[model samples]
Every structure is written in C-alpha cells, then in structure tokens.
Target: MNIQMNNIHKSFGTNRVLSGVDFDLREGEVHALMGENGAGKSTLMNILIGLHARDEGIIMIDGKETYFANPKEAERSGIAFIHQELNIWPEMTVLDNLFIGKEMTNKFGWLSTKEMKALAQEQLDRLSVSLPLLSEAGACSVGQQQMIEIAKALMTRARVIVMDEPTAALTEREIQKLFEVIRALKKEGVSIVYISHRMEEIFAICDRITIMRDGRTVDTKDIPETNFDEVVRKMVGRELTERYPSRHPSPGRKVLEVKGLTRQGWFENVNFDVHEGEIVGFSGLMGSGRTEMMRSLFGLDPLDGGEVIMKGHPVRIRKPVDAVKHGIGFITEDRKDEGLILDFSIRENMALTNLFSFSNKGFISGAKEKDFVDTLIKRLQIKTQSAETAAGNLSGGNQQKVVIAKWVGIGPSLLILDEPTRGVDVGAKREIYQLMNELTERGVAIIMVSSELPEVLGMSDRIVVVHEGRIAGELTREEATQENIMTLATGGQ
Candidate 1:
C-alpha cells in the first residue's frame, strides 16, 4: 500500500490543527512522523482514517484518489491505527475486546468461540504476550493493555499501520519484541507510519522522517541523513540547549521516610527516604511494583503494613484527602483517568486541589480562583485559548502541564510524580525539568517513578531501584549509571 496526502488542512472551530501538511508512506518502509504536541501529527493521521475530515487536501492510495468514510472502511482496506489513548473495553473480557466487531460465525450464524480463542491466542503468541483471554481488560496493567492494542491491530493484517506512541507504555524487552515484529512486517511488504516523541526510537527504526511544527510540514529527510539535534531544532523551530536542565542541590532535613512499607502481594518491606530539596527517582521495569508502591503512599491503595513519617513525625494517610491535608500531592501515571477531569475547564481542574484556599465561609471566590489559575497557566507555559477551554481539548503535552500545575497549586511539601513525561515532547520535557528544579530550589521534595532510564538518571539526585516489589538497591548521583541501574533493577549484583 502506498499513501500520499497533499496540502491537508483541518480546523476545529477557530483552532487550526493542520495547515498545508504533506505526508506519504511507501510499501515495505517505516516512515516516522515527528513533532511537538499539537503539531498535527495525530490530527493528520485521524483525517486519513476518516475520524476527522480534511477541509482541504488530496489523499491518493496506490495512485488512486480515495477517502475513507469511517475507520471501519479503512480497516477493511487494510489500514489500521493504534491510537495513543487505547480503545479497550474495560468491562469486557480480553478475548471479547480483541474481536469485538469481527467475530467469526458458523453456517447457522452462531458465534464461533473456539475459532476466535485460537486466533486470538495465535496473534498474542506472535508478540510473545501472555494474557488470560477470560480476564477483564480493566485488570491489566497499562503495559499489558498496550500489548493488547498492538495484538488487536495485527489481527487485522493491516498493510498500512499507523502507530502513535506505541512504545510509551512498553518495557525495554517488549520494545525489542515490537521492533522485531516491525522488521518481520516490513519483510512481508507492510508499510508503517510511526508517530512518537522519543527521538531514539525514531532514529533507530524509521527509514525516513517527517517533521511538523505549528500545524505545518517543516521538513522530511532520511533517518540516517538527519541527527537528533537537527530534528529537534526543526520540530520546535528553536535551539534546545539542554535536554535535561542542571540543578544544584543542597540537601536539608528529611521530608518523607517510609519504613517497612508493605502492600500485600504487591510490594513488601519497602524502605526509603527523600530529603528536602532533593529528587528521588524510582526505577524499575513496568510491573516491578513501582507504581503500586506510589499508590499506597498516596492513599490511592491500601497499605497492609508500613510507617510513613513526615517532618520528623509519623503520619497516617488513609485517603487522598488525608494525604493532601498532610501537605502531600500525587500526580498519578494514568493522567487521563486519575489526574485530570477531561470535561472540566482548565481553571476547574487546576483548582480542584486548592479549593479551600479559594473558599470563604463555604462559598467559592471566582476572582481568587481565576487569579490562581492564570498565574499557573503562565508559570507552566500551558498553551490554551483561555482558562475556560476544556482540558480534553488541549494537546497531550499541555494536558500534562495542567496536571502538574494542579499539584503545584496545592503548595505541597512532598510531591509524588509517576511517569511525568511519558508522552510529552522534548521542548515540554525540558520545561518540566526546569520546573522541577525550581520546585526543589524552593525546598520541596519530589519522588519520581519513571520507566525511562535516561530520564531517571538525568534528573534524579538519588536513584532507588525496585525489583519484584522490593528495594533492590540505592545509588547516589555520582555512582549511578545506566548499566548499574538496569543490573540492580533486574536483581543482579
């Protein structure tokens, strides 16, 4: 399959998402789409699959002008899209999710359960995934759910696959497996449109790359012909001096100390301490119990046995409100589900944690709330039309900034951040790192749990490795390296 999109233009109300964009895909080649958030990467692909109509453009597939009426039409034509936000039916079983609309039927129009299970198992086996077909989709981890999405796309036998942020939730081992699958697919004459913010993955796997900025095509070059700095400069339209901002730390008294923290069947006997004005990074594999431990600390999950000490005294955190009242803020990993309310306006979401500060006599002060929201919006450099704009309408990077701003408004002594830059762009990630530096300078302690090893190493003052729900080891900034961190995370001496 060969696809060519020329002069694509799209808009939602007054917001122009794509303007005069050109993208093409050749058979048996992996083409990459690189851009900052809201740079029209996803929007352009959405238009191709008929989720959104292009106001002005020409789409030619195999030298024939074509436009899909809907995603179903595109799927039938061997074009499949694995979206950044997954489309799993949480209430349904994994098997049901994999074959939702394309179930097999017998001669009498009866559903062929045996055939479907066999087919599903075959697809999963190809990807080296082990999942129970009868288990509810909601019970799976984010990484497992990502694999399920990939398997669902492969089940269609798509000739043209558009994968947006496919590796964001995957572990190192799974990513290698996916790269192998991509290689096999290319050998079978399948074309791929890869969209991601990770520069390493883009350069590693993509044959050609297209850069977009502010809803317009910037440039397209062969992957080998372009370098990381050049790609970032083209995408953001400026020079990014540093990927991770440098911070000078001056440690103070201990802000948070966890002793014998145990969550039954999850993490056990975890112990660590984060000092004031320091950033403690939690590094591990996807299911190494890093997120589970953070959830227990934030009161989102129950702790079987543990001691949480804050400011030299033991504290009890039984709920989110309790944690908040104790001057602790948590930014969860799954931001769409746990951190932000999509339907609410930016101001409303930012004020959720600090409502009491803006309230008097059981009545809310709109002026105070607006003032606070405006301040954080400017501080965090969040791009939106206005404070009245719905959070869901913003780009992925802006939504993450909003989630961070929400916690920053609460004036926390200790903040827990999980996967803070999972899907964010390079420019926005630098800004976030700067913000973290500023926060630590103001004497706030941060506990960051991340899957990206580079990020964990670059930003952490102290690194703690988690392996199978236990604290395997801790490394100082001078002692930590990628090899040693991975070794500890995998239970190596």
Candidate 2:
C-alpha cells in the first residue's frame, strides 16, 4: 500500500502551522521524517492519524482518496500510529491493554481470554520481548511499555504504521530488536513512517527521508543519496556545529558526594564525587539504575542505605525540599509529570522553586516575580507568546528549556539533568549544550544522565557506567568509547 498526503494545510487561530505539505510512504519501505522542534512534524503526523482534521488536504490510501473523521476510522482503514508518549492503561495488564478496544469474543459474547493472550503473546514474541503479559502495564519499565505499544499497533494488522521517536527511551539491545521487527514488518509489505531525532538511527534504518520545516515539506531523498549533515541542514535551515561543548574543569572544592548509596534492587553501592565546575555523566542502558540512582540522590525516592555529602557535610535528604535546601536541583527525565505544572503560566512555573525569593514575608511580590521570570525568559530565549502563556502549549524543546529555567532560577550549587535532550531537535540541543557549558563556567557542579553515547563522550569530563544496580566501570573522557561503555553496561567486565 502507498500512503500519499497531498497539499495539506491547517491553521489554528492566527498561527498557520501547516501549509501545502506533501508526503508519502511506499509499500515495504521505512520512510523517516526529520525536522527541528515546532517544525510541524507532530502536527503532520496527527493529521495523518486523524487526531486533527486538516483544513485542506487529500489523503489517498492505496491510491484511493480516503477521508477519516477520527482515529477509529483511520485505524479501521489499516492505519495505526505509535506516539512518542506511551499511551497505556497503567491499571490494566499488558494483555488487556493490547486488546482493549478490539477485544476477542466468543460466540456467546464473552471475553476470549485464551485467544487474546495467545495473540498478545505472539506479538510480543515477534518483537523478541520477554515481559509477562499478565503483569500490570505500570509495573514494567519505560522501554518495555514502549514495546507493548508497538505490539498493540501490530495486533491491529495496521498496513501503514507510524512510529514517533520509537527508540528515544529504549536501550541499544531493545532498539536492535525493534529494528529487526521493523524489517520483518517491511518484508510483509507494511509501509512504515518513522519519526526520530537521532541522526544515526535515521541513517541506519530509513529507506527514504523527508524533511519538514515550519510546517512545510522541505525535501525528500533516498538514504543512499543523502548524508546526515545534509539532512540536518535541511531540517534546521543552517549548519549544526558540535553538539557538545568543551568543558574545562575548574577544580573547586567538592560540592556533591554520594557514598554507599543503595536503593535496594534499583541501585547499590553507588559512590561518586562531583566537584564544583565539573560535568560528570552517568551513562548506562535502560533499566541499568542511572535514573533510579539520580532519583534517590534528589530525595524523590526512598533510600534503603547510603549517605549524601553536600558541600563537605553529610546531609539527610528525606524529600525534595531537603535536597533543594541543600543547594541541589534535579531536572527529571519525565518533564510532563515531575518538571512542570501544565496549567500554570510560564512565569509561574519558572518561579516555583524560588517563591521565597520573590516573596515579602508571607506573600509573593508580583513585581519581583514578573521581573525574575522576564529576565530568565529573555536569557533562555524561550519562545512564547508572553510570560503569561501556558507552559504546556510550547513545543517539547521549549518545554525542556522551561524545566531548566525553573531550576536555574533557584541558583543551586549542584544541578542534575536526565536525558535533557531526549526529544529536543538539533537546534535546541545546541542551545542546551551551550547552557550546560555556561552553568559549569559559573562553578556549578553538573551531573548528566544520557542514553546517547556521542553526547556522553563529547560532554562529560568523566563517565560512570552502572549495570544491574552496581557500578560496572568508570572512564575519563579520553578513554570512553561506544564499545567500552557497552561492554561495561552489559556486565561484560
């Protein structure tokens, strides 16, 4: 089947997001879509999936003009989309979630548990995923949940599948498995539209590439006919410089130290020291305890055994407030859940951790809060209509910048960022890298957790690898390599 989108145009109030955009996906081929943040990649995908009705367009399915009023209609037409955000029913079991809306039934209209389980098992097996189908969806790891979402799409017998940043949270091994499944699907003549920011993966897996900018189709090319730099240039409208900035260690006194930090099954015996002005990276595969250790350090989760030494003093951090008072800031990996209050305005979100600074006695000073937010907004170059605009309405990359601004407003001595550039585009990623360099230059100790090996190697002064709740190995910038990190991360030591 071939999916062709012709001259799509959409507008919201005064913003004309998409304009005469055209794209296509051929049978048994993986076509990648690349663009910077706010480039209408998600918008176009939403239109294709029928989440948003385009004001003008012709969508042809198998060379026949088709119109879908909703996602259900699109799904009925053999179209399915796996969004970047996992949409799973956490309270339900994996099997139930997989076949929820499209459940199998017996002649008497009773739920066919055996049939559904068998089908779900087959889907998971095809993906080489080993998680139990009876387990609650929330009990699984982020990467596992992602795979289940993919399986759900496959179960629909979707002829044209759309994957949005499918491997953003997956480990290298899991990504390899997913690539294998994609190849299998292609062999069966399924047309796939892949969306991702990882240039390496795009180059490795895509049969053809489409670049979008400002809601317009910029260019489309065969993978063999184009290079990574050319694709990035088309998406960003400019040449992208070095993604990670060079950092020189200032070597001030130790600011944050963790000794024998243990969180039972999550991580154990994690010991490291971050000195003032140094950027230390925590690199590991998914479920390798990097995020869990960071959560424990920031007092977001309980610690079974360990000690956190802050500025040469052993401190008991029982909660986030304690960590904040100890001059530590944490930017969480899930920004939507933990980083921002979506209903609030951008200024309000930015002033969350530092309300006291803008308060007089028991009441907040409106003038001071405004001044503070305005300064940070200008400094960070946050793209917003106004300071009063809702933070949730911004693009993913802008929202990430808001998260960083929220913490920096409090002026912490140590800052921890997890997957800071996970869904961010190449242009915003450069800005984030520059911001980290600026923070380090100001003598702020930084701890970064990243899944991208190139970023880890290029940004950090030292890298620490964790495997199965234990410290597998540690390497300096000079010694870190993809092979070395993988060997340690997979317990090959």
Candidate 3:
C-alpha cells in the first residue's frame, strides 16, 4: 500500500500548523520524516491517524481518496501508528494486552485465554522476542514493551505503519533486533513511516527521506545520495557546528555526596559524588533504577534507607516541595506525565514550581509571571510565537526546552536531568549541550541520566554505570569507552 497526502492544510483557530503539507510512503520502503521542534510533524501524524481533521486536503490510500473519522477507521483501512510513548496497560499481561479489543472468544462469549495466549506466543516467537506471555506488561523492559506494541499492530494486518521515535528507549543490541523485525516487515511488503531525530538510525534503515520545515515539505531524496550534514541542513535550514561543546574543567569541592543510597527494591548501595561545576552522568540499562534514584533525590519517591548529603550536610527530603526548598530541581524522564501541565499556557507551566516568588502575599501577579517566562524563553531560545501559547501545541523538542526552562527559572543549586535529548533534533541537542555547559559554568552541580552512550561520554565529567540495582563501575573522561561502559552495564567482571 502507498499513502499520499496532497495539499494538506490544518489549523487551530488562527494558528495554522500545517500548510499545504505533501508527503508519501511506498510499500517495501521506509520513509523517514525529519523536522525540528514545532515543524508540524505531530500535527500531520495526528491528521493521518484521525486524531484531528484537516481543514483542507486530500488523503489517498492505495491510490483512492479517503478520510478517516477516527483511529478505528484508520485501523480498518490498514493504517497503524505506534507513538513515541508506549501505550500499554501496566497491570495487564502481555497476552491480554495484545488481544485486548479483539479478543478470541469462546462459545459463551467469554475471552478464550488459551487461544489468545497461543497466538500471542506465536507472534512473539516470530519476532524472536523472548518474553513470557503471562508476564505483566510493565514488568517487561521498555524495549520488550515496544516489541509487544509492534506485534499487536502486525496482528491486525496493517499494511502501513507509522513509527515515531521508535528507538529512543532501546539499547544497541535491542535496536539491532528491532531493525531485524523492520526488515522482516519490509519483506512482507509493509510500508513504514519512520520519524526520528537520530541521524544514524535514519541513515541505517530508511530507503527514502523527506524533510519538513515549518509545516511544509522541503525536499525528498534517497538515503544513499545524501549525508547527515545535508539532511540536517534541509531539516533545520542551518549548518550545525560541533554537537557537543568542549568540556571546561572548573571542578571545585564536592557539592553533593551520597553514601550508600538505597531504595530497597529500586536501587541498592548507590554511592557517588558530584562536585561544584561538574556534570556527572548515570548510565545503565532501562530498569537499572537510574530514574528511581533521581526521583528519590527530588523527593518524588520514598527512600527505604541511605542518605543524601548536600555540601557536606545531610538534608532530609520528604516531598517535592521540600526538595525544591532545599535548592534541588528535577527534569523528569517522562515529560508528558511528570514534567509539564499540557493544558496550561507556557507562562503558567514555567511558573509551576516557583509560583510563590511572583506572588505578593498569596496574590498572583500576571505581569511578574510574564516577565519571568519571557526572559527564560529568550535565554533558552525557545521557538514560540508568544508566551501565551499552550505547551501541548509545541513540538517535542520545544516542549522539552520548556521543561528545562521551568527548572532554570527556579535557580536550583543542584539539577537532575533524565534523557535530556531523548526526542530532540540534532540542532536542538547541540543547544541543550551548550545549555548544560552554561549551567556548569555557573557552578551548579548537575547529575544526568541518559541511555545514549555517546551523550554519556560526551557531556559527563565522570560516568557511573549501574547494573541490576547496584553500582557496577565508575569512570572518568579518559577511561569511559563504549566497550568499557558496556562491560559494566552488562554485568561483566
């Protein structure tokens, strides 16, 4: 099946998100979409998946004009979309989730558990995924859950699949397995629309590439005919310099020290220290409790035992407010769930943690809020027309910038960032790296948790690798090679 969108125009009131957007995907080929934050990729995907209606356009499926009123209609037309965020039930088993809406039924109209379980096992085996059918969905790793979502879509016989940031949460080995599955799907004549900010993945898997800028098609070219620099030029309309700025050594005395930090089942005996003007990285597998430890530090998660010493003084953090008062801020890994209030305006969201500073005696001051957000917006280089814009309407990269800005506004002594550049484009990623450098120059102690090895090596002054809820090893800049880090991360001696 081939999908073609012609002259698609969509708008929310006076703000036109997409203007004459044109793109196509062909069978047996992966079409990669490239864009920066606020480039209208999400809006276009939403239109294709029937989440939003196009003000004017033509959608042709298999060379026939069509319109999808809802996701069910799109699925019925053999189109499926796997979002960046995995949509799976945590409490449900893999077999139950796979056959949820379309369950195998018995004569009494009850679910046929055995039949569904067998089918689910076959699907998993076909993809060479080794997860048990009876295991709860959330109990599995992020990569495993991603595979389950893909299997569910394949079971529906979807001819065209739209995958957004598919490899954001995957390890190198797991990514290879996913690429293998994608090749198998291509062999089966399934057309795939792959959207990602990672240039390496795009060049590796895509047959053709389409670049979008400001909601309009920029150019379409074969993957082999172009290099990363060329594709980036088209996607961002500018040449990017070095991705990571040079690390400046301004390490002072220890600003944060943790001795035997334990959260029982989450993490055990975690010990590390971050000095003033230093960026320390936490690298581990998906479930290695990097996020849990950070949450505990921010007072969002309870610590069973251990201690957090700030500037050689132990501080008790019972809640998020206490952490904030202690001069600590956290930019969560899951932005949509923990970071931002989507329905709120940009100014309102930025003022969430530090709203009291802008209020006079419990009375809010709109002018002060605007002044604070306006300065941060300019400083962060956030791409938005106005401060009144809804945070949800921004692109993933811009939304991430907003989250960072919110914390920067609070002027914390210590900042914890998890996967800061997860869904951000290369251009924005460079900006973020610069921002991290700026923060370090200001003598702020920073702790970063990321799955990207290159990022861990590039940004961190020191790296700590965790495996199975324990500190596997630690390395300085010169000792942090990929092989060395992987050996520790994979539980090697």
- Model 1 steric clash pairs: none
Instruction: Estimate, for each residue in 345-402, the C-alpha lDDT of model 2 and write its tens digit.
Output: 9988998898989998799999999999999888877877689878877777788889
lDDT of 1 by residue, 308-422 (tens): 9999999999889999988899998888888899999999899998999899999999999999999999998898879999998888889999999999999999999999998
Q: How would you encode candidate 3's per-residue C-alpha lDDT over 255-278 as one tens digit per residue?
A: 888888898888999898999899
Candidate 1 regions off by >4 Å?
A: none
By TM-score, the better pick of 1 and 2 is 1
Ranking by lDDT, best first? 1, 2, 3
Q: Give each model's clash number.
A: 0, 0, 0
What would the TM-scores of all predictions be? 0.99, 0.96, 0.95
Q: Judging by TM-score against the true structure, name the best candidate.
A: 1
* Sequence-dependent TM-score of model 2: 0.96
RMSD of 2: 1.6
Clashes of 2: 0
- Span of ten consecutive residues with least summed lDDT in model 1: 330-339
